[model samples]
Target: MVDRPLSLYCLLLPSQKMIHRLLTTAVRGLSANYRDVIYYRVKGGERLCRTPFAVFQERESGKLSPKARAAMSPEALRKQFEALSGKKRATYAAAARKNRCEIDLRRKAFKQASLSGFSHFIKTTRQWTDLGRRAKEKCCAETEKIRQAAKVERDKMVEMYYSGNAVKH
Candidate 1:
């Protein structure tokens, strides 16, 4: 059987019991996304991540370990690296703040005009409010009308049954 795909938002839902995350790569040391995780369950509620949850696990590396490396020569290591060609072994070179700012400025404008401005926001919000009110009013009116019609039909049915105006068919 195939396991259903779990949504990121589904993890935080009210009654969901379990949440699982697949380990892509377990980066070592303390970065922004690496921390010890703990889970807990409430008596009346659901199981939740209780502690700091940075995704971490023992990462299975492609290259062989140092103890296993004693038999292999320099050529073998080079061949292994070549085999694992695309995996990045180091962090990116962080550009200076000044350079970053300059690049940002060159790439895009500082201020941007939106398709929907302040007036549009007000209009849209008012329209939503109006639409909700209209829908509520319409539902109430229709339900009341339906109830009244049902009552009238029921009264007619009773009269017909009593007056011998209808058969079982």
Candidate 2:
């Protein structure tokens, strides 16, 4: 059996403390450099970078006409719309259809112009256009064909008294 003195056991303590202090100081220096060079640059970059959508929205909002701005409350507008004659309503519908077509044409032109920059968006737009609205609607309707049956089953289950599951013992 060997009895080691406390002072002998403490021989490596100074070297370990020096190593730890050096590592901590090195890490602190490296982190400070990283914060100054990388972290600050990235934080500043986010503030400086304006996304394409943001730029588009800014320009689009600037193009809004004063007459196009709605002054009436939504309720007032709804009442006005409801009070309109069938002929006037039909006219409004036609105008809305024309406006929608114009907007679609503008959007298509914009996408074509920016196709070189946003190739991914063009691919996605092509995929979406490949599935027409009627096709998508029919697919969704087919998928939801059992919805009514499920609702009826739910109603039957909820009416536990009428459902013959009661114990007769």
Q: For model 1, how does the per-residue alpha-carbon lDDT over 23-128 read when each residue is reduced to its tens digit?
A: 1123324422111111111122211211111100012122457676567665665565445524232211111233344324322221111112222222233221
Q: For candidate 1, what's the RMSD?
A: 27.8
Tell me each candidate's TM-score.
Answer: 0.20, 0.28
lDDT of candidate 2 vs native? 0.39
Model 2 lDDT per residue over 27-82, tens place = 43333422222211222221111233332233333466656434434465466567
Q: Name the best candidate (by TM-score).
A: 2
The lDDT values for all models are 0.31, 0.39
